[model samples]
Target: MERMEHTSNADLRAAADTVLARLVGDVSGTARLREDQWRAIEALVADRRRALVVQRTGWGKSAVYFVATSLLRAQGSGPTVIVSPLLALMRNQVEAAARAGIHARTINSSNTEEWEDVQDEIAAGAVDVLLVSPERLNNPDFRDQVLPRLAAATGLLVVDEAHCISDWGHDFRPDYRRLRTMLADLPPGVPVLATTATANARVTADVAEQLGTGGSSDALVLRGPLDRDSLSLGVLRLSDAAHRMAWLAEHLDELPGSGIIYTLTVAAAEEVTAFLRQRGHTVASYTGKTENADRQQAEEDLLANKVKALVATSALGMGFDKPDLGFVVHLGSPSSPIAYYQQVGRAGRGVEHAEVLLLPGKEDEAIWEYFASLAFPSEELVRRTLDILAHAEKPLSLPALEPLVELRRSRLESMLKVLDVDGAVKRVKGGWIATGQPWTYDAERYAWVARQRKAEQRAMREYASTTDCRMEFLQRQLDDEAAKPCGRCDNCAGPRFTADMSEEALDAARVDLGRAGVDVEPRRMWPTGLPAIGVDLKGRLPAGEQAAPGRALGRLSDIGWGNRLRPMLAAQAPDGPVPDDVAKAVVGVLADWAKGPGGWAGGVQDPQPRPVGVVIVASRTRPQLIHSLGARIAEVGRLPLLGAVEYTGEVYPGPRSNSAQRLKALDGALTVPPALASALAEAQGPVLLVDDYTETGWTLAVAARMLRRSGAQGVLPLVLAVQG
Candidate 1:
């Protein structure tokens, strides 16, 4: 039962081969090692006892473990261990290593019967190397079933997607933090090697820190040439959704061979796949929803050239390797430019001049905003969770946490997982143990926090409607480089680059409406009758001056100010006050009738006479108003500042009460003329028709041309306010 040992690298490799022969008899596999990979392999074998390999995704990272284990087995060192994110990946690595004539096995949740066998093999040093998902390693059964048995077990912990260890890294996993705990429980001197597809220098350094391995710079950092001369990358923004699909259709026929059309949703993937197939393109749909058998079939079909393209969700790329893929067509705006670039990277894997076309349209932002709003946890749920975790005596299981909290199962799980990563909870053998719970919120404080959480949700919603470059906007807020536009993003592709609020941009020849770069003759938001150094919205009537500096915005609260434009602040009059003449007439009649009570004719002084104008500037809103309103000057009796009033409060006059419902029956002399839309229609150049919301964009489309913008113009309407 004694294990043999060898001091020399050659002897170790020879012994490793003999050990592998015991399991996978003396087979040899291809060793097409890149120069850098070969160098890392040498460093792995030449080392005294332990080695680490940190490499990119496709650089054959799994090879380091397989090849090194071969050399180590020859040295008479026991089994090597690898832990990673996916079950399929572990299985693939283990199978490939076996085919290479090295004994390898995988233990994970997916395989029930073989799991015990694999663990048993690792225990007896029957397997040269063992592969398992991180979950399997974290199992307490690991210590009981296997760890104590291998006398020469050289534990080689390989973490795939290694960037997850750092909070600042692109991908962070709560389970990753617990990895340090797992490592500590292992025998000392075990080398942990972590690898990922994409990570920056900061993330790279953190990987080493998280692993607690002061392993030598012999700690490998190998990035094969980014000089993917075969890949031709290009960013594109389309004319519209229809046009974008047209481009896809044209390209499918025009391209060379296998392709990937990555859509933003499962619905999109299915729809596109069906549409393309109907058009005789031989397409296949592959998404997370697709069954396992179907997914593998789709992948195989694409690889065999039976399918021209695989229409898949974001889930598809990381799961499989389709090397000969010819092009990658992006179907929508990605959450970040980084994601866009990474998804596009799937193409041109095996050939020269592989094309990646980005398809972006205006509606993509709505999709993105919807996606962004999905991040917040319900406030009530988070509050209850903090309370539950705070008082916990032991690790809380999903079943226990569910009944103790008042939230949907999925959201609570995610928040608890996040709390775990934040060091608030530690995962134990059974469930989770709280570490530093902050659950002492009073009722009022919880209410206040809830309000703030809701506000933050609104802020994130508003962020999507921002007129800034989408990439630069996200980068600035998230990465602290807000204005640093990724030239590859749609905003950078906009006709105008400087979309910020600079005095220069205010007077620039062209201003980016950001998403909408329409060719508006030039106009600023202005109330009527204001010329004080203000420029009238260009392409409008001669006197259309810009909005005044001191002018305030108002909203319509009540139907008192009949046919009058509402501003943000209180109106000069609230109740409908009668004009002097109308008041005099009513008073005179009442006085005559009251001269003799009998002459009153049961009228009793005309019931306090209604105000002359029921002009209601609707103002009933939560909290106090922000500013005051003043005399709104009018152009042809049209108040351009009227749109600003819509911001004061949400208008739900009634679901059935359309904009013009029962207007003629109102007892008012002023007719609500539709002159404003007409005036906007006549404006030349590019004109930005301001509105708070653009649900159907009927308002924008109706007012489109008068804004002097065409469907084909270099500009489009810029809508601001809360996202729709």
Candidate 2:
């Protein structure tokens, strides 16, 4: 450590205590920093050294930075710049700094209107700290214009959630990798600090190595036990989704003060939220789909204990601070123990004890596979993207590039960011441009990452089934040297919760799960730059030719019907007649659709007219399934069976393709045969357009337009499953 003889150790300790008291708002004057916290702060403030503190949540990681900022500012240093990952964390840190009479400002996507003013304040030395998201670090204007100036002047640099910088970490983000550029630009003697509640030995080593970049000395590493004394962990293995839902509805009220209930998917989150609310609990759903304003309100409500709980997906994880959060229950297991540890750490932070439970389901693996497919694209795709950017006359926006590549928009953007960090591509004013740098595709490294992911999945499985202490198992996974049986968990102390639930709750859960039918809204507008791909589609879809809002039996991401639909819809599944149970469920969906709000018989502003006939879309993979379903619906609804729309082109590309490519492959794929045209021309009202599945919704849209142009008055789409 770099030592300074100008100040005595005793005097430095006294100053640190005074700052802690102000930061914590401790009027009692008894607040003092722990020995390790003091060591970390002293290294940054007095020794001017980089440090990585791997401590558990609520271990006062923020306090170390804030106290150091206070001491540094007193010596006439520039403001501390925190590269935080989440908005919630930044807000909490800003509030905590205010208690110490420190002026803090934030620049993020939500406050773009105020960036100019915040920048002015920083220039005038009016702010003590400035928080920015990791994404902001690589934004073209910020990186090329504002970043160098800020780095040259920064007093102290803090990387919150530093694990994200490591490729091995559970939450690795490409944007965090851009920090290396700023790190290299920092003026001499600018101390740096990286902090996280999660990160195993490998991740720790990786982050520490990065911290040493552009510096002459290595970072001082301080790691502690990854155990929470207030957490009583356990696992409850149930038969199926119904049992799990029943258990939650019965025991939600029994969980200590208000807390969070996590789901694996947005659909599942919404489903759980609705089920709990129906069970007389005041709960709201929080997911990536939630509006920004609503997300803020939900956070505030949870902070003030206004709601019973928030049923959420992984989007609610990281940087969400609730000192007294009572419990955290996962409806399904996360793929990694490191990730689960970070999430459960949110609880038991400020309380004497809190409940932690995992209700693992058989379907969790399917969800894991779905997410795994979205990992880094193959080498071929990456090379194609680079080649396109290299030869382009000018910068190409994401939309303009979409038609040229087969990857989804979000995945494409993420790949570009990683390329930018590696110096192969540059994001400019209009879009992205190639830098002509020689880049090698590291096949070995990518393969190792894939293997590591599988290993984590296996570890999570072992975590759920192990008979040993749950806390010890998790600690060991994190490579904590202090791993040991906590003696406070359910396995160590015997069960504190019963597997048995009230029969009434089970029956209610069944009824709710048995309810079918979800809205499959029609795609109204064409994807941008479609004309560039040789297809003429552009702008809003003609209203008269579009299909009416549609309905489906369930989402493949749901806990109820999803369980039944997944296996039947698998690509490897046999193409046989529809199963008896699924046929009944389809009938149930139609029945519910007719009577529910917006249905043919329900009260609404503009109810859809009852269907006149049924038309089936030919499916190469599930021809029998589609034919049987369409015939059954026609028989039950007492409507004639309109002829099918024949497939007259190359084999379908399936659901894995992106919007532009899917539309291109489907442009001249299907045709309306003469018999189908005649039947549609004779139909009196809207037709029930049936398909086995809908992923991108392009197939249905195109087919609906064909039927409408041929002669059907209106079309209402029905599908077995809606892929997210």
Tens-place lDDT digits, model 1, residues 309-330: 8898777754355557787877
Q: List where candidate 2 sits over 4 angstroms from the true fold.
A: 1-6, 213-218, 596-598, 601-604
**Best-matching candidate per TM-score:** 2
Tell me how far candidate 1 lies from the true structure as C-alpha RMSD in angstroms.
Answer: 20.1
Query: Among these predicted structures, which one has the highest lDDT?
Result: 2
TM-score for candidate 2, please give it: 0.97
lDDT: worst 10-residue window of model 2 = 1-10
TM-score of each: 0.55, 0.97
- Flag regions of model 1 displaced more than 4 Å: 1-32, 48-57, 135-154, 213-220, 223-225, 373-383, 390-408, 421-423, 426-724
- Candidate 2 C-alpha lDDT tens digits along 212-277: 722345557889998899999999998988899999998898999989999999989998999999
